[model samples]
Target: MLHLITYKYNFIPAGEQALHIVFPEQINISENQLIQELASQLRDSYEDEITDIAPAYRTLTVYFDIRKTNYFKFSNKLKKFLVNYTLEKKNTYGRTFEIPVCYDLEFGIDLADVASFGKLSIPELIEIHSSTRYFIYMMGFLPGFAFMGNVPDQIAMARLEVPRSSIAPGSVAIAGKQAGIYPVASPGGWRILGRTPVTLYTPDNPLPPFQAGDSIKFKQITRADYEAIKELDAHGEYQLKVL
Candidate 1:
């Protein structure tokens, strides 16, 4: 017996040899978890044109093969699955990562300001930021950089008015309602409270340390240790990036 539920879909002719499933607004109810779990189910039930599935803010987009599966049957089956969807609130689909950060002046250019804005001293900032466990909402903008958040309101801040043209890789930053690690060297606007030793965007790597619904923690490390990790990472034989 199917319950009362509704879904809307669109078809796209992509060159990748697969149909795309777009759940744009349907994300608000039960997002990443729903997409991942539901995708597993739908993929198992239907064996056609499924290249990959990507989940974003309140939306899930899947790529599939059009010839193997027509849109009508695909939509019907997906609609039924969604109507009977069983949402699961979970901690992580990937791995919980403990990252080391150096709030030292050499790397952290905005720490003092962030501390001042939050009315906390340097040590207080460290304690507050490191103590709290954050939720990883999604990974985008660049590889390995998880769009994460839910920082306790007390420490939240708005993004920089003028986005920086170049931010060093491995920067750890925060913004309105969220905080995250910078995975690559790129233009960014997030206020950096510190810098982590973790290398997030590794070209040719399929998965980063984070995935949707993952949890991240900040651990304090001395500047010396940060440099040592940098050296080790440069050698390319270390496991700096985790599940």
Candidate 2:
């Protein structure tokens, strides 16, 4: 049997060509999943009029071609569609990905600092961080960069006051209640917890295997395993373990 959850939402004009469907301002998984489902439904139902649909934590920004449809007409259509929308509770929502991470000091530069801030030993911090399966609220900032969330309050740390000039790719990090992995080498301020060996992004293939409405669980691994996995991944031999 499935239960139904009621949600209140509003549509706001983003610009002449785009609009936003705004929901409650919170990081709840159920709401985000609904946003994802709505995005998919809109794309399928209004592909001819809509150019793009971007789903975030609490908003779905939809862009439509003015030639085919204006904001007012589209908004009215969306309003009617939403009035009839219903989300059925499910036993499972999205795929769960197990990411292998190495928390050695060399990669996790801010490991000690974050552990200290949490008043925990390194092992305790690692255990707490890796235990939770984080939901991918959205993917932004860069390709393959997933903004996940709700880190355990005990170990949730804030971003660095000053951003780093260069952060290596595959860096697993946390900021406040959010967690993410740096898909590529880029400047970032998120507190570094560790690094993953998987190739998250590449110019040849920009789209990531994962996307919004998915789940990620980090698995702690040794440095040796990291090197071995890195080698296999580089050769396109390693496959990500997913549930």
Which candidate wins on lDDT? 2
Query: Candidate 2 residues 72-163, lDDT tens each?
Result: 89999988888777766543548899999999999889989989998999999999999999999999998889999889988888899999
Which regions in candidate 2 have their CA more than 4 angstroms from the true location? 1-5
Worst 10 residues of 2 by lDDT: 1-10
lDDT of each: 0.70, 0.90
Clash count for each candidate, listed in order shown = 6, 0
* Candidates' RMSD to native: 4.1, 1.8
lDDT of 1: 0.70
Worst 10 residues of 1 by lDDT: 1-10
Superpose all Cα atoms of candidate 2 onto the true structure and report the RMSD in Å to 1 decimal: 1.8
Predicted structure 2: lDDT: 0.90
Across 1-243, the per-residue lDDT of candidate 1 in tens digits comes to 222244454445344444455555522324545556666776676645566666665555666666676556665666676666654454444566788899987777788888888898989888988888776767787877787766666678788999999989888888877788888889999888788776666767646756777778888999898888888877765464342
Model 1 CA deviation exceeding 4 Å by range: 1-30, 69-73, 88-94, 204-206, 237-243
